[model samples]
Target chain A: EIARAAAALLRKVKGPVGPLAGRKVLITAGPTHEPIDPVRYIANRSSGKQGYAIAAAAAAAGAEVTLVSGPVSLADPDGVTVVRVESAREMLTAVEAALPADVAIMAAAVADWRMAEDAAQKIKKDGSGKPPTLQFAENPDILATLGHHAALRPRLLVGFAAETQNVLDNAASKLTRKNADWIVANDVSPATGIMGGDRNTVHLVSRDGVEDWPDLAKGEVATRLVERIAFALGARDA
Target chain B: EIARAAAALLRKVKGPVGPLAGRKVLITAGPTHEPIDPVRYIANRSSGKQGYAIAAAAAAAGAEVTLVSGPVSLADPDGVTVVRVESAREMLTAVEAALPADVAIMAAAVADWRMAEDAAQKIKKDGSGKPPTLQFAENPDILATLGHHAALRPRLLVGFAAETQNVLDNAASKLTRKNADWIVANDVSPATGIMGGDRNTVHLVSRDGVEDWPDLAKGEVATRLVERIAFALGARDA
Candidate 1:
């Protein structure tokens, strides 16, 4: 009953609030697979929950949201136009297609390196004397590319810095290298279940400074993020 | 087979890399659930992934890791000592207990408010003509408390800021307010997925400046973070 009332109140409040009604938001989610063979590929565990949640929040805030997602099984969020892609290259293409958005959030766990050349067929292991050496090459830095773009660059270009030590120092360096307006940093060791779990704790960094928040649910984070975006755009207009 | 080989190579290369060894590292994770009733409480979705990952990485780097976790189901990482708590108060107690460490990472998403009094029994929904007003009181600022501790303060005190707009500005304010050595910042909007997902993107902020990183797997972030921590500690030692 309380939840229902709160939801009703929210609807009432949102009816008159079009903070981002005409804004276009582009988001990337999940892990891009770097294929080594027809059947096998290198991929990380990224559930796309964060990206999906952001899409929902952006739409709720009245933004026209385009979600460029990697291969994930999650359902498409309401009011969000989702574009699915397989590899980093495909994701980049999709992002390019969704250009001129007001905000571009690069949330996908893009593989930094991919197999130099994908194998036509899967190699069979017959107790080979030596293992095959799979050559790799660095993939495009999507955030940096978009951030440094002369055109089609969103007003706000945000990147993620997942660091373990000197977290601040490394994030600061990245801010300049990527030329991003903002960066979010967190530590993601295996024991924390950050990669596959349902909750997160993070920090926000930018030119102005840093702010630390109490750990909260992803949903809460999404809602708060939307609120902030709305406030930021509104302040700009004012 | 490929994974095993990579692990072997990593082990061989890691032996000569002493970065955080002989360091006493402390970390906090998850959300503190402040109970209003036995079955009801205010809690956030802080799975403690970032903090746990930090602990694991520190341990992997040969540091003595003490993890003070909130209510979470995650098992303790290998070679890590885990201290579990249920509420902000408990979390504070646990953190204090593991103090005088070389570094302290505050990653728990702790609730900022708690019911003044926990109801012994669930509030009956007698369809009371009006909902009962529950009084809330402020919870302790764990980050600030530790960051400003007069004695046994860690050499490095890291805090997280989950913000939406004016991210850098707000983070900067927090750096001063909390007296934190560093702050990790993120939008935490549903789109970014820093919360309960397997992947994350973030920014690092501090007195020196900001650094941003490209989107990568949470594990990759952890590995990179560990490397930074090792380097920073080594530099300090030297």
Candidate 2:
């Protein structure tokens, strides 16, 4: 009995299959839209393929995953609970509702700003030939908010830095600024063909150092990321 | 013989059901992406549904349509030739290639700027945690270029004004600036539900004046616009 107990503890600490069994993971994916109006919105070029892949991998790893997704054309992954939303504000609310998880990954490309004041009616053209000025309001930073939340914060907080330049430095800064344990940074320059593409090259940024990852399919990246998360959390239930 | 000749000319003026038969229409739709690097890009929220609707309507009206589209999830409309592109430069090139048309509609939300300098390799984080500064270069104005083209300019140069305020004024200004014959101005304020929504409210601004149109589905709008184009061209073939 003593040997068996020791072996079980070792399995909990070391890498083990089904390490994330009974673990609750929270993930956000897709592009958060900022409404310019009821029919129009401010959005990004995120296909949500990466985030969706991660959610599926987490589920496959035996985690109960809640994916807070923005509007996209993808079908929901099997064995995961999905909360669909349109705007950044709605995404934030949905994320907050799925809190108190073992891990929280902020992977969605949330719009930075939204129209400060949306017109009530369809704006009409006046006689003058000048353009109207648009005022903007900053959107909520979901990763930062949940990372530094006073309560209901996840045990492990991870964020993503999808940048064109300064991938590592930007991701490292995001780790500190967002109070995240790790950041998965990827370059999205057009030449790389990663944006809206299936393959990605990633760099894992943490306090210790940055680990460069080779280019792989988004699905493979997701599996590796899930493995890392499981190793970090140990074989423990949330 | 004289009466038959007169009727033949009259058929040319009236929409013979397929008024646009053999007429080539060039259109640009969706949001143009501006790449920051190999994997990241700067883009906007444009569903490409409006443009697709226009293409479908144009095809239904017996016009040979070439749609220059950006990255969007929606499938290609039947009977339309779609030329898919990623960045603003690619879109501009594609638009130029599909020229010499009777009507040209610039409907894509082209990105204004792109990273002036893109890193050839994935940037790594040094000891310093500062983010890299990004410089921008302006993208070519597709509407202005085609509208003001010395040659190969479409008989009906139509441009869309997606504005938040001063809808009429901005649209009128766009007509003069872009040298377009007509401007279809629409307000994208959030309450209007015209942005990604199927319905739209438009103001047709021409040299005569602004004609305010009530909210209608994109398909209806397309039908009306095609009718107007047919009337303007007198059933002429390009």
Candidate 3:
């Protein structure tokens, strides 16, 4: 009986595990809503699908996953611990809290510009026919910050670039400027229906070279991305 | 009066003109369905957005656009021609009839598999309750055929891939296999929400190398793509 118990325990321990076993992965998703007023704010159509999928994929690959998501309606994926935030500052704080991950994927559609000063209350449309002149400011580049961290940075830091013209040239510039390991570039023109669609087509840009892929369902992309992450991690460990 | 008439003639002769010039581009969107019976057929949720958007973007960029789509009922983008179809064979014919374009982009989600023999009538349920077996055959690769013509291929050949793992590695393989100039790759696990949602993240792969981009609105992506295409064409001419 004792021997049988020991064998069962060993089997449990030796079972096939995911590639990300013992690894930690951090992901950020959705668009931060910068409050312009108590009832209104600036936001985009980021649904947090890609980020959530990455977190789920990492977890399935046997990693400890932390998902820092913006104000999205999606439920937390199974096997992932989710931290929710509304503003860019809050998202940064949440990301900092989920530190020391093996990989950090910044898939969030962060707003580059925000209101200079959020109004405490909604401003009424005055009889003055002129439109209101609102001041704006630049938001921190989260991907750059995380990617260029001298210490406590993840082994792999990935960023995204959404471009229209000079796609490759601009993406290359961003990759070098941001110090990211990889950058996924795509043409999200309103005509592509990628902003909130179930299918997507993208390009992968790395220091080595550029690789293009066929259009695919989103689910398939996540599974593939997780597998690649695993292989990349394995190579790094070796 | 004679001098003015001569000047007008010269201006008319010098004006830029091409087969695709000022003509609307109409595209068939997404994969097709070839039914075997009332309840059975082969289908994929391709979400007609990519091709449809291309049509719209092309139109927006100055070409008149028409979209002969499948069953998807997405709102007709402003200023486009839309025709709906149901089968690959139908799509092919539609495409042929719509040709003589200045530029045609084949971005539809074409099926690569179809029922070997579609039954004219529905098969009745058997007394044994055994499910009817399905036999499938390979469907045509529409993009390759249309984009690889010795004389009729589009000026630009673009293909899409929804890969689950080793995306770039596999994308590189497909680029050669398909004899295409560009491939768009997307990681499409269920979590990516790229198929039915409002936002997308993607990568652009090509021969030169990889270039990654940040996430942006789909409309922005389209506008940028049009701008890039224009720039590329201008550079080619120069």
- List ranges where model 1 is wrong by over 4 Å: A1-238, B1-17
Interface RMSD of each: 26.0, 7.4, 27.2
- Taking chain A of candidate 2, what TM-score results? 0.89
- Candidate 2, residues B1-238: lDDT per residue as tens digits? 9986876576578643376877899988887766554434556657788888999999877898999999887899988999999889999999999988989988887775556775564444343533344565666778889878998889888999887677888889889988999999988765677767888899999999989888899889888998899888884533
Writing each residue's lDDT as its tens digit, candidate 3 over B64-183 gives 666767656478887677777887877777777776554455556665555678765434334343445556566566666666667666555556665445667766666776676666
Candidates 1 and 2: which is better by DockQ?
2
lDDT of 1 at B87: 82
Give per-residue CA lDDT, model 1, range B1-238, as digits (tens): 9986886587577642246767888888886777655334555545677778878887877788898888666779888999888889888888888888888888777766666787764343233333355565677789999888998878888887765456677778889889998887766554567666677677788899988867766667667777876677668878
Scored against the true structure, residue B78 in model 3 reaches a CA lDDT of 72
CA lDDT scores, all candidates in order: 0.74, 0.81, 0.68
Model 2: runs farther than 4 Å from truth?
A1-21, A31-45, A60-62, A84-97, A109-153, A159-192, A200-217, A224-238, B1-17, B36-42, B111-139, B235-238
Highest TM-score scorer: 2
Q: Candidate 2's error at B189, in angstroms?
A: 1.8
Q: Supply the TM-score for candidate 2.
A: 0.71
Estimate, for each residue in A1-238, the C-alpha lDDT of model 2 and write its tens digit.
9986886686578633365877899999998766544334455668899999999999878788999999788899998999999888899999999988989989898765666776554333343533344466667789989988998778889899888787788998899988999999998766778877899999999999999999999999999999999988874433
- For candidate 1, what's the TM-score of chain A, rounded to 2 decimals? 0.89
Ranking by TM-score: 2, 3, 1
